[model samples]
Target: MSTPQMIRTPLTELTGVAHPIIQTGMGWVSGASLVSATAEAGALGFLASATMTIDELERAIVAVKERTDKPFGVNMRADAGDAEARARLLTKYGVPVAGFALAPKQALVEQLKSDGIVVIPSIGAVRHAEKLQAWGVDAVLIQGGEGGGHTGAVPTSMLIPSVVSAVDIPVIAAGGFYDGRGLAAALAYGAVGIGMGTRFLLTSDSRVPEEIKRRYLAADLNGTVVTTKADGMPHRLLRTDFVEGLERTTGIGRLVDSAKRGLEYRRVSGMSWIEYLRDGIAMKKATGRSLAQMAQAANTPMLLKAGLVDGDTSAGMLASGQVVGLIDDLPSCEELVDRVVREAAERIRAAGATLVG
Candidate 1:
């Protein structure tokens, strides 16, 4: 079949991508390969940099540039110790976009915008979106409860329209979105596009291990559970033996485990104890997370690495969206983007036809 004509929206116009689909930056899953492929396929992709050191992130950025000249983004924690330095590195490379998991400071947003980089932050609440927009962010991506990892209680259907109505900036809807039908619905709801995490992570171009991919594929719609057991915040993850054990553990036991993981992370990340403490303090000030929650935050990357990179499901946790059950195949990024765009155009046209004069 001939390729479907490209559908342009505010997101596509701002990001310079042919399609409005966004492949979210999933730590340990989103890397150079996936981001480049997504960019080449005419969608925006973000390199997950929160898990990487500043040097690693620069290298990853260079790797993506080598693979594709298309515009892409790098996702980072706004409160990271090296955030300023990372921002400078992005400027050095002339990266097109910068994405933040948490709301960045006004200064950081200004710096990126001045450097000609589009700043898009992910938010879970309408207030957050309004604040980001007021702070002059280029756009915002809002993830609902059905999305993977840390999520809010509101479903996407309700959350998208709420934030869209509140913010003048472009809004990209996430959570429970995986295909063309979702794209159409998001646009109808006033969003400029849809951002997908789990759907992209399950793609053939993603670097997630084969075993881990199989595990994700086997899950049914009911296979995901949202629990605060992994971290102090509500995190959505696959229902695995490891996750179940975490849910069953007492608060004290979990705290002890969190301490252990925090130490392990410090070692793996090569951060001095002083540096670790500083980062913890920054996280506390930014998110208002308690000390215990700060320690538990260390568990997220380590556990995800074990499952997504090492393929050890028993030893690690898998962050996934409720949409996992809806996925069955591992199509390449190009094919997936093409199919979704085509289907969205057709659905939108069909829906418009039903409107009475």
Candidate 2:
């Protein structure tokens, strides 16, 4: 029995635009075309700026603006040296909401709030939600372990209830969400709504190659694997030969290759040698690693670009949530949103009828 509800969650309220739904920002996949389509479909879209250069980001933002007057958000890297500059661009472009993939400092949240922007950060743990609530975040987007990209061990089944009990803010449940059934499940767990990444990635509006989209659809549950060998974090990726090769390396030459790759990555990212080194230094300080060791770590932009823009899965890590396993077909952004809502409505009605003894 798939029980659903007719409850209109708080996320439906117009925060800065006219949609209750939010499209999770998918790195290279969330370009202008996808963002605009989502916005036009009566949902909020997010432009992924982490994968783009400043100039590319500006152009994409402008393109989205031209395509729709509805509000949209931009995902940014909190640890980047130019993060402040990117934040300022939000004010310049008058973006409706600012969504962070990682938890941001309270100061940045306060600043954005003061500027009248709604601040929502994606979190995987209840403790993180409590911290964000204390930091004055507007809402929390919770992802379960089933999600692709970077995810925590806790599933939405456990995390949503935990966060709801620990905090009083809106919770957006992510991870395995795809259809209305997922939305209904999220509501049952006390989340305000759902945010999707992989589901959207399989849509017609998605810019990834058809073959790649097909690869995701053919995947069944448990197809994704978590590997820390990519970049420095535990990244969920398709079990491909490239990932297998990296996992098998255990020699001096491997370390040297990693260092050389990081250097080349620095050049391609338009970051000066000093700034690149600085980021590495800061990362090492935070992670308790030696500065020199982190200097050999591949930067986020480079790794994401290698897979996102260049589509070379062999080169670096691509962040994906576990929902990729369930996708079966690519529909237009409008069609996808409509199908979700329509299915949700039907589910609501059926459940309501059952209660009408």
Per-candidate TM vs. native? 0.97, 0.90
lDDT of 1 by residue, 1-357 (tens): 224446899998999888999999899888999999999998999999988877888999999999999999999888888788888988999899999999999999998999999999999999998888889999999998999999989999999989988878999999998999999999999999999999999889998988889999999999999999887899999999999998999989888888887788888777888888888888889999987888899878888888888899888999999999999999999999998999999898788555477
Give RMSD to native, each candidate.
1.4, 3.8
Question: Candidate 1 — which pairs collide?
Answer: none
What's the lDDT of the predicted structure labeled candidate 1? 0.91
Off by over 4 Å in 1: 1-5, 352-357
Show how many residue pairs clash in every candidate, following the order shown: 0, 7
Encode model 2's per-residue lDDT on 1-357: one tens digit a residue.
Answer: 111223466786635443346798887789999999888877778898866777788889899999888788998866666677778788888887888877776788988999988888888887888889989999988888877776778877888888888999999888888887777777778888888888888888888877666667777777778876655556677766666787786645556667777777777667787877676665554346554446445644566666666777777555667777767788887787777777777776677544354
Worst 10 residues of 1 by lDDT: 1-10
**Candidate that scores best on TM-score:** 1
